[model samples]
Target: MSALRVALADDQALVRAGLRALLERLGIEIALEADDGAALLAQLADTPVDVVLSDIRMPGVDGIHALQALRARGDATPVLLLTTFDDSELLLRAAEAGAQGFLLKDAAPEDLFDAVTRVAAGETLLQPVSTDPVRARFHFRDDRAPVDSFNPREVAILRLLAGGYSNREIARSLFLAEGTVKNYVSVILDKLGTRDRTRAVLKAITLRVI
Candidate 1:
């Protein structure tokens, strides 16, 4: 198969350089690089790439804005957001804007490469471990719909999932059938308005569900 071409956008030169080196070492082609979101969009208009790796924060036209612009223009390119920390609110916004995945900037090279490949291949990702910090910071609010909306069982399952528990493990811990855990997970995702577990976990943190 031909090497996958990727576009990168980050205000930090060094971050972009580091990502470029890592991607190249993995035999991925760097189709375009931009210092900010608008430039990234402009480059996308002129070049075709398999995936876009963008930093969530930027000086002008951040990753969220860029993603909205792309979606507004009917562009279907997959996007993987990078960040220095697991910002629950920011990542939740990215998901609403159609981001395919979120990864910490300091993530291992293998993690980065795998994320790029998976997103390029049209799969969504949100690491259980990566979302742990936000999960840990979850402060339940009575007024939040998420906190008030999810049942006790859903809440328990979410906590376990954040701890990197598999469905089987969560089932075992909660003393429920695996099928029951799966149903609860699906309900949690629906309530959080996310399609995948990663986004659901991030949204839950943003909504203070845990």
Candidate 2:
């Protein structure tokens, strides 16, 4: 297989250098590097990559804004936001902004590599950081529609979702058809009153259902 080409963006030069070394050691190719989100986007306009590894906070455009812009332009490229802080609000914002994964800058190299690979393969990754902070800071609105109870099988699927498994992966693990897994995911999202898998996982965590 060809090496995974990645675009890396961070404000700190040292951090970017360290990450580049680690990724290169793992045989991953760095297609482009940028000091901030704006540069990252500008470079991406000319360079295509398999994945994007970026810091969530930066001087201009930041990771969240960069990701929003990418999605707005119909770019579905998987993005993994890295951060030094474990701020719950930022995590939620990243998820809402269409980030494929969120990881701390201090994450192990293997963990970082795994996150990139998984996101590149179309999996939503949110397991590196604990969800307790999210649950604590999540404001539950009383006016929101009540969530439906999930069956045992659905709960099992929720667990897999929390682990960042894609529908096809979950289907294979549960010995179900891919289409069936998609249906279960739809049901889970409905039960959680969420519009996306990441939001569903966050809600599930907030509800302590997974």
Candidate 3:
């Protein structure tokens, strides 16, 4: 497939520079880069990008506003929000504003690429490690419950895992054998259509299963 075209918007020059470098390394094209949300909107007027990676907080017309403006214009371009804090309120706002994905500013390079690719391919991308703690702390509304594919017990295990518990710890906490916990984790990964625990946790969180 052709390299996906991506636009980046962040107030920090260094953050934009670093993200550009990372996207280039992954063979993703930098269609445009803007220092803030207003500039990002202006750039989008002329640039046709597959995805937009915008920081949530900006001096003016932040990511949320930008997303709102895009929706107001009836633009269907996918947007992925980036933030430094894992604030549940902020996340809910982004979701309400119609962000296609949410990610931490410090996400791993691989995770960034994965998120960009998935969002570009029309998938919603919200990872657990970034949002789980805030959701747990604030008890965010479980508006998007897990699909019927994920059973209740598996969702329980995923919630514990998202809290950073290890397999043995989850086994002890859930009163299951370590082997059984491992098997459940594998099943969770499969059901979530992810290849690893972290991704599974994230997928579950995005689905509001945890």
Candidate 4:
């Protein structure tokens, strides 16, 4: 496979340089580097980058704004958000903005690389409970209908799956073992009559079940 072509967007010069060095050492291509969102946006007009790695709190045009702009223009370049904030609301906003993943800035170097790879591969960043539980909690407010095939626990698990949470995170969020969550995910997929989480979410959205 081609080395992942990446862009580094951050206001701090040193941080950008350090990230570039690390990614380069990993053999990933540094397609572009920018100090802020506006610069990143400018680079995109001429440079075809695969993954955009951005600081969430840059000056002028922030990461969130950049994400919105990218999505608005139908640019599907996967974005990995780097931030110090563990705020759930911010995470929710990032998810809604179509950010592919979230990474704590202080994370170890390998963690950063892993996040980039996972996001580029179309997996969500490490959301502990996925976004499904939150979405289900907020969107699935009414109990007008029930699934005849699934029990309440199954439905609860399925809701998390639909929201896009990973199995490991779902396990921790629900206080279940990792293996249990994996089983739950498999069972949820079978019960929902869908192939995967994204499709399951789409199905729920289509049926108004989530």
Predicted candidate 3 versus true structure: per-residue lDDT over 64-133, tens digit per residue: 9999999999888999999766466677677657787788888899989988887787666554335655
N/CA/C clash count, model 1 = 0
TM-score of each: 0.67, 0.85, 0.65, 0.69
Among these predictions, the greatest TM-score belongs to 2
lDDT of 1 by residue, 1-210 (tens): 999999999998998898899999999999999999999999899999999999999998999999999999999999999975547778766766788878888789898888888788776665523445555554444336667888888999887765545688789999999999999999888887768776576667657676
**Candidate 3 similarity to native, TM-score:** 0.65
- Give the residue spans of candidate 2 off by over 4 A: 128-133, 136-148, 171-180
Q: Name the lDDT value of residue 188 in candidate 1.
A: 89
* Candidate 2, pairs of clashing residues: none
Model 4, residue 111: what's the lDDT?
78
In the range 1-210, model 4's lDDT, one tens digit per residue, is 999999899999999998999999987899999999999998987898879999888889989899899888888899988877455566556766777777787878887788788678777654432445445444433334434556767667667765446777678888999999888767767755667565555445434455
User: Which regions in candidate 3 have their CA more than 4 angstroms from the true location?
Assistant: 128-209
Candidates ranked by lDDT, best first?
2, 1, 3, 4
Candidate 1: residue pairs that collide: none
Full-model lDDT, candidate 3 = 0.79
Model 4 has how many clashing residue pairs?
Answer: 2
In Å, residue 100's CA in model 1 sits off its true spot by 0.6
Candidate 2, residues 1-210, lDDT tens digits: the string is 999999999999999999999999988999999999999999999999999999998997999999999999988899999976646677778787888998887888898888889989988888764777768756567324433466778989988998899888899999999999999999888777779888888887777777
Which residue pairs in candidate 4 have backbone atoms (N, alpha carbon, C) closer than 3 angstroms, thus clashing? 130-165, 132-163
Reference-based lDDT, residue 141, model 4: 33
Clashes of each: 0, 0, 1, 2
Better of 3 and 4 by lDDT: 3
